[model samples]
Target: MDEAIIAKGLYKRYKRVQALRGVTFKVPRGRVFGLLGPNGAGKSTTIKILVGLIKPDKGEALIFGKRAGSTGAKSLLGYAPERFSIGNNWRLIDFLVYVGRLHGLSERLAAERALYLLEWAGLGGYEEEKFGNLSAGMKKRFGLVQALISDPEILILDEPTEHLDAIGRLEVLNRIRELASRGKTILLSTHVLAEADYVVDSFAIMNRGRIIYHGSRLDVQGVVRIVVDKPAEFEKALHRAGLEYSISGNEFIVETSGVEDEKLVLRICLDNNIRVIRYDTSSSISDIFMRIVGAEKR
Candidate 1:
């Protein structure tokens, strides 16, 4: 896949606070890469630099192999900011058309794109509805349509489902996954861990403007745990099989190096006649994310 985005030694500062400190990473073409960070950790700042909305104090950002801010590169991507603020008085369909036209489409083409996106976003009959009258969830759906009207090859979304309810979150996440499966490159920035795990093919964890981890899903598949009673006996069972284990209360975390180790653990437990109260595997993308992203002091 062709490279969709690249950044090197990027830095930004805002009057006493260094928002970004030499951040750098790349997103491959036709994959969803999640940019994850805690609040004020520079997730939004890195996004701003990548989209050319704000200049970086140092280093470079590239989109579609072209430098960010280049006229030739600007049209290849769509952006959805963290906040949703649009013309409240305009009809949903009309607003999308206006956005499309600004991206270089003719009026008729813009209108066509607008209608298509509105319907795709589940706002088919509500196209003629006033934006201000729509509920918060509906407004977000409309905002999504605005971002997608240009049919961009790369999508840069900042907190796309922030502050939404369960249904709304699922709605947006499903749409994001659908877009990626269609071979579009997505650079997703969000503080929501569970949803990002579902949509992203890879991850880049940022902390106060620095890139700490950048890798594929397999990289995060370390040992994870599910707690149950009688962990001591379980620990000894694993020990007999030459597998190491750690413990926290009744919860025992056994490290299964790979698929073979995982199977070995299950077999040993079954053979011991242990009353498998609750057996489960360890290690998940979310576990790795939380551990590294929320590192503590010694």
Candidate 2:
């Protein structure tokens, strides 16, 4: 199947709070799909449904054509929740092996896989460390290691880098990129758009329990930035052409559809004797996120 996960018109209400409102999106196979939004945006709720932790009050979710939360679907997936609890007494290696066994691995194989993964995740010599003894960053990485024990085809990570320092966040993100390179489909949910900016192939922004925008990262509509030597003439020309734009010093940012619109801007500048010093398309992920969610709020 081309789509790895599909949420179809999902709706869920808890007491007086509506967690999901006809939420819908698809995660394509072998690609990183980011579910981004602020807190209370229902990102967690949608992730829960995908991982079979909770059943939606209405609509359905599918995992490779299998009903979400079904045995078949669960077997092919790995999950790392934003917050998880483990006994303080449990040893890191033992916990991972136990989880591997539950997934049907032989005892010996489970131990072997656990050790390999722990080392790969930078926890090599800490196999015997108690769960509560590890540092916060190590604990988070351990959670990720355990989820990967069964070598799942799909990974669902909820706020994987939350509360981590800059370095910790980078380490976790690099691991995610490596997994994607190995052809594993990932559904990463986070409030920080910058965390997923470099890795995500496509994304959906959620707010108020609904998706405000969904599109490929490359297709995100960012402003066209132009640097001109004749700032006054350029500004006047833009005003005459009735184009929506913003100016800061010598740079002019014009919102445009594509190359055609860029060409139009260029022609306008040329006609007005406005020397175009530089022209480019540049916008950060956070910029795109704010634009989309802000518009939804209005």
Candidate 3:
């Protein structure tokens, strides 16, 4: 896959805290890549370095082969930070236009793109509203608009859906999906693993300044839960099949490597003549996230 962004052995330190420790990952072009982790896990720091807001003390960050923080890379990237950094006084349209101009767009082009983005972000009639006067959801939507004003190849969003209502979150997620469909490479940094699972093609989970998990969502190992009429027989069948499994009360929790493994478990129960009562799979990003990060804490 063509890489849209690459971080090689990235290391950063802030006084006593080591924000990043040899972190490295690649975001494939034209896909939604998630940087998922808990608070203070260096998601923001990694994003900051990629967007040129801050420099890494060691290693390198690159955007499409150009060093991150370089003018060429900056032009290809659009970033929306975790916090709202725009001034309160500017009108929504004006603010977006200003951001576009800063990205080297002409005044006429800036206005044109701002108008289109406002509509795209569902902020059409609210263009004249002051930035401070909008609702929390509206502000988040506006932040997204400003980020897209430059028509960048890559969009980096930091906690885009944080603190929003369910409806607002849905709106933002749908917009992200739309952008990805149009071939824009997206880097989504969020602590919300479930939400990230909804949109990401692949993700990297970070904990305490280090990456603990990195893989495509389809390849994520998850547990398959099965309840059969005969617990003893089911356990015996699983053992005979040579599959790693754990017994939980009457349910069998089978560790699955992929979709194929999950299907194989069902086949094993059938072959053993075990009547299946309930078959369910729990492959939530949060499940593995807790397992990995919790292990590191120990």
Candidate 4:
């Protein structure tokens, strides 16, 4: 696959605290890559380095084969920071237009693009409003508009849906999917794994400034939880069916090879005349995240 971004042995420090420790990852072109971790896991620091806001103390970050922060690389990148800020006094349209012009667009072209973006961001009617007066969701949308002013090839978003309501989160996530479908490479840095799972084709899980796991979403393992009326009979059924499972309280977490295995577990319970109270197939990204982090701590 063609790589759009590469970080190799990236290390950063602020006084005594190490923000990044030998961080490395490759983001393929035209894919939504998730940089996932809890707070202070170096997500923001890594993003800042990629966008040229700050330099790494060691190692390097590259964009499309060029050094990060180089003019060629910067021109292809757009960024929406975790904590977005804009001049409060500036009208929404004016702010977007100014940002567009700063990206080297002509005045007329900037105004045109700004208007188009305003409509796309659902802020067409709020153009005259001051940036400070806009709601949290509106500000996030405006930040996205500014990032897209130059039609960047890669969008690096930090906590894109941080404080939005349910509706607002859905809208932003849908927009991200649309961009990816249009062949835009996106690096979404977020702690919200459940939401990220919806759009990311691949992901890297970070912990305490180190990436502990990275893999395609399709390869993520699935577990099925089943609660039954007869625990002893269920265990016998599982062994007879040659299925691996573990019991916790009243629930059995069956290790499934795929959808067929999940179905087999249900069939086993039925064949043994066991009553199943709950059959849960949904697996959470948070569960995997916590398991990894918790194991590392021990």
Candidate 5:
């Protein structure tokens, strides 16, 4: 496969805190890859390293075939940080035009692209709006527009939908999907599992500065949902049987490989005299994510 981004054995430390511990992953060309984890999982640190804002204590990051942080690599990449830093007094169009010019675009072309992108991002008439005056969601939309001003091949977005409302989030997500469809290799970092599920082709789950799971969306495991009266006893039984599961209220989502595994779960319940209130074989991304993260905690 043609890899667009490669993070090989990357490590970083902030004084007493080890932010990233030998983290590694790869994103293929023209695909949407998700770097998923909760806040403080070192997702932001990894992104900073990739964007050349910080150097890793160990390992390396690569964009296409070029070393990450190198001019060659940076030229092909665009980034939107979790927190944006821009002049409060600058107008949206002017800021984007300046960024485009910095990327070597001519004055006229930069201005044209700035206007076009602002319109596409639903900030058309707001081009004259001051950066600080715009609402949080509008600022986020403009941040996205700034990232695309240079029309980069690879985009690294850190929580791109952070402050948007429901409708705004949907619009931004749809835009991301459209970008991937146009063959732009994107690396999206977010804590939202459903957001990743909506657009990412593959994902890596990070927790406590380590990568715990990495797989494609189609690699979703088979799971069975069971609700029983004796929840605590059933949990104990599950532990004795060495079966992995996650609890939410009266429900338990247990992983199963096949029919035999499903039968094993039922057998455990029967052996423990647990009264089954309901049972079904349905699962969701949130369930799977919680299960994986929960197992790591145990």
Candidate 6:
């Protein structure tokens, strides 16, 4: 895949806090990449730099090979932050029309586009509703409509699923995947692991302003259950391998660095005739996130 966005050693600092330090990741064209982390991680800070909302203290960020925040770069991207950043007083359609105009659209065309967006977002019946009166999910759809009004090549989303319930989250996730299928590149920053799991093509897991892991979902192991007749021998092997292994009953908990490590252990066990009774790996996105962020307890 071609690179649509890239960041190298990005650093951002506040008066008393270093929100981002040496953060780096890449987004390939026509794919939805998950920018995942727990609260207080640098997901938001990294996105702000990508969308031109804020500048980085050090290092570099680019959109389509150009410096981030330049008009040429910004024109290629649209963003909807975690917060409802649009005007609350306007009706839903009005807000869409207003944003369309801001993007240099004519009044008549903007109106037509607004109606189309409303229907597309499942809000056609609520066109006259005030933005402030809409439910959180509705507001999110409204925000998404405006971001796409510009018909940008790239989309920057910060916690897009933040205020959504189960159905709402699924809708958003589905929309993101649809966009990716249509060749739109996306930077999806979300705490909702299940949403990311269902939609994202790749992920970068961050923690305390640093990226701890980044790769395809297939590479990470979220859960492991190992069964062996001589548990002590397997436990010793795990220790010698310098892996983070836990225990529950006679079952061993193993988290591989990636598929490569998992293959290594499996090969060794099979060769040694270790009577493995059971072994399983979890693909749960939530479990992956917790382990990556060091938030999992045993």
Clashes, model 1? 3
Best by TM-score: 3
TM-score of each: 0.87, 0.91, 0.95, 0.87, 0.83, 0.84
Candidate 5 C-alpha lDDT tens digits along 23-85: 999999998999998899999999999999999999999999899999998999999998875
lDDT tens per residue, model 2, 1-298: 9999999999999999999999999999999999999899999999999999999999999999999999899988999999755899999989998999889999899999999999999999999999999888998898899889999999999999987899999999999999999999999999888887877999999999998888887666446789988888787888887778877776888876656777889898778888878988766567678877888778
Q: Give the better candidate number (1 or 6) by lDDT.
A: 6
Looking at model 5, residue 184 earns an lDDT score of 94
lDDT of 4 at 190: 90
Model 3 per-residue lDDT tens digits across residues 26-130: 999998999999999999999999999999999999999999999999999988887765778899888887878888889999998898889989889888888
For model 3, name the residue pairs that clash. Answer: none
Cα lDDT of model 6 by residue, 1-298, tens digit? 3899999999999999999989988888888899998898899999999988899999999999999999889888889999865567788778777778888889889889888878888888888888888899988988888888878899988999887898998887788888888989988998878788888888998888998878877766545678888788888887887777789888887877677777766875876678879888765667667766665324
What number of clashing residue pairs does each candidate have, in the order they appear? 3, 0, 0, 0, 0, 0
Q: What local lDDT does model 6 show for residue 256?
A: 78
Q: Which stretches of candidate 5 lie over 4 Å from their true place?
A: 224-282
RMSD of 4: 2.7
Q: What is the C-alpha lDDT of each candidate?
A: 0.82, 0.89, 0.89, 0.88, 0.88, 0.84
